[model samples]
Target: MDDARRTAAAPPAGPGTGPGTGPSVGLDIGGTKTLAVLLDAAGEVVAQARLATERGPQGVVAGAARAVRGVTRQAGLTPADLGGVGVGVPGLVDPGPGTVRHAVNVGVDGAPLHLSRLLGAELGGLPVGVENDLNVAALGAAHLALAEDGPGEGDAAGVDLAFLALGTGLAAGLVLDGRLRRGVGGAAGEIGHVPVDPAGPLCPCGQRGCLELYASGTAVAALWPARTGRPAPVELFEAAAAGAPGAAEARDRYASAVAAAVRMLVLAVDVPAVVLGGGVAQLGEPLLVAVRDALARESAGSGFLSSLHLPERVRLAPGRVPVGAVGAAVVGRRAARPAPAAGDPRPAVDHQPA
Candidate 1:
């Protein structure tokens, strides 16, 4: 099997399943769809389900509850048979209270939606934790990395990496030293708004020539609209492969920008890996190669950059699995575990910036 296929089938890692803990369920709740997964104790995805997401506070809770039930049922189990559920949502999330606000796409407005409390109540009191969508994806990527090259020695929490999402927008999710780094105000990975061109077009975030303008999937669409009405990235890559007009240049420019994002992550946090994710990552190997080539060019002139091994650290996110959902399962499993006693040898989350 190819590497992508193998990575897809590889089992994830989390705390072992013990008495009274069957499996964990995770949900990646988007504006249009809710993707759910049932992860067994061994970290293999046993069952999965996708359902149309209903809008509003009550709809969000109801949809999430139904998705959890549906996925668990597909595995011939009920919520009672599961350990816990974790939810990933896009918005300003106060994980402490499991509340989300400003999730306009999901029809959630300024009023904080009590997602965890409501979803848990809907699930007959199953433990539920809600987190930012990108953070869960980062966590999911870190969990998946256990089967990659294996974690570093003395690293017990999990792999340390960055999950760079190249979807409609360009942002990243960071897993530093086996813990999610949400930053102090939960804006840790908002790299898209970082202005790289002072004279470039104005961005909605009030920046000119923001990195998202050059790197995101939306940028591809704006750069090269598909005449065939397919995804712009698909069309652009196909055209470039066919040696069509100006396609390769556009592709390289996009890849170069993406490489910049990778450089930013590695240079700042010095993560060992940067997993390419989000919608555009569906381009697969071609996207990987392009970014690697760009990184090669970037490092060729600077021994300092070369020492970081940027290209070697880049990899595509697992293709077949819902990475965000798998991460939600990891979160759920961790939430169900009891706090460690005093003087436990395990490491706490290091909040100091790198």
Candidate 2:
């Protein structure tokens, strides 16, 4: 989503690395929609499908199946030899067993069973692993950043990485020492619902002024109407860019809230690098410059949170864009690897079904 910041010494793969030649499919399932990419073994997308999200849990699963089938057909492969399928969904996901503990927006609770358990048979027994969408996005970004900073064909660099998704809510995925930390019950990076302002506004979780309401795309849209008669952030951004009085005012408020969000994330996480992704990050320079300035002004004037250094890896995502589905697919490869054997090199990716 961060097109401008993505440009770097590392460019995305050329047009040749599509389906049947790479890792197969990367499926990202969101609260309102689902997308899938058919990649060859080379990790390049051969075909992609975006499906309108449906209501009802079964309807959502059915929609996902439809997308999977669409991409498989495009790739000219049957489900039988399709390596593996990775699904990235919102909510708490257990990476150990690839179980979906809960998907609040997707509407499942108390571990409604693993999607892989039921869909496994249909997917040619391919390893169907589920993961927290943000975690997968982090993996994708990590791979890109590693490739960008390292020798050609980006191997994991030693740098720790944090990927933040700013959408209807806020949350982050962390990577250190080339490994992802899926905390206890898989709730580590679930920052969006965390209450940041206890006395401000009521949140879905019965808290006041959660980070989501103040720093997400939803937050920006909510402030849009007050600044300009229009309620759309995209329109509001354009208005601000054009120097429309109301739009500029609304953006300033949004910037302040977002800066606070950034401060909390950077100061607490203490990572050397952080990359911003999601629909809201598309605001481009407005967000980039505002955040950089905010952190500078606030951090320089304060002693607390002053210990965190200016990040070396604080650019936006690369041109290919960071999508949870691609992240999920990459994770599928990792989860499928055989358990570490004595003295064996780490098998980072596995295409065979579990």
Candidate 3:
């Protein structure tokens, strides 16, 4: 019915039955937009929808419900036919409590927002999994990486990957051996708050010189007004490409900070690859080139750093598909699947991030 729905081949049946046997929904809630993707059993997207994000906790929850319904309707599916729903939010999430601890952009801070309860009620008790947005994006990235490399034991085993997002904020998603890692307190990849300089700039997190303050798209746009009397990140990048002095300096600094972040991640976890995603990642090859050059400069000065091969590990995520939404779908699919019985010898399902 709606233009957003396009017919795709039906997914093949697998281990499950009943409502959980059909397609699942994945929702990615960002500061500005919300994306809903209907994913078939094999994780391929069948239909999708998008809407401007609503402000405040209630509005956000309502918007998410509408998105789910919109995509399912487009895909010719009903709530009862849905397998599960997975949501990715931008702030701190406690999966056990099903709450978003704080997300200023969506107007929830300090006060816990019970997103799962609200969304679950709206969906009439559908199984829902909620996780940090970047973490699910990491899962989606890992899935893409494995898909491109082909299915094999060695290909799927010991797969260590990271998804770096550089949008309004900077953070990472880490997947170790095909499992998402949300460290103690569920803040493993909050690399944006990592102190990069003592005298750089103040961060809202009550820290000075945080990595996000220098490298995030928000930071870049903030610098643009002072340099070119405009506050647009796109214009800033354009100016840098056109050789504007101030814009060039700002661009180079952002690239250097991102390179530093990559180096830190590599030295810390030594993931084999890092997929760059998020709104800022739309800068594409130019941004990738800048980061590679910066990493190269660092490796040139230190033999220890050179051994890390940072440039070889960094890559831009596919810009065409919404990685976060796709990852959330994977999360929902896993959540809906029945757990293996005791002594079944199959690995337990891991859905920590959301």
The candidate maximizing lDDT is: 1
Summarize candidate 2's per-residue lDDT along 10-94 as a digit string, tens digits. 2222222322233546678877767776555555455666666654456556666666676666555655556567788876666
lDDT of candidates 1 onward, in order: 0.82, 0.64, 0.78
Q: What's the true lDDT of residue 308 in model 3?
A: 84
lDDT of 3 by residue, 1-354 (tens): 332333333443232356446678888888878878887655567777777788798898888888888788776677667788888888888765568977887777878899888888899988787888888899778766766654342445456898999887899999887778888777888899998888877789999999998778888777776455654666777889999878888787778888988988888899989888877888889889889989999799899888888999999998656888888877777667676688864332242222
**Tens-digit lDDT track of model 1 for 1-354:** 110111122233233355325588888989888888878875567777778888999889988998887777666677887877899999889877899999988999978999989988888988888888999998888777774444342343655889999999999998877778888887888989899999999999988999999999999988898799899999999899999989999999999999999999898888988999999999999999999999999899999999989999999999878999988887787666565699874433211110
Sort the predicted structures by lDDT, highest score first: 1, 3, 2
- Pull out the clashing pairs in model 1: none
Checking candidate 3 for backbone clashes, the offending pairs are 130-354, 131-354
> Global lDDT for candidate 3?
0.78
Please rank every candidate by TM-score, starting with the best: 1, 3, 2
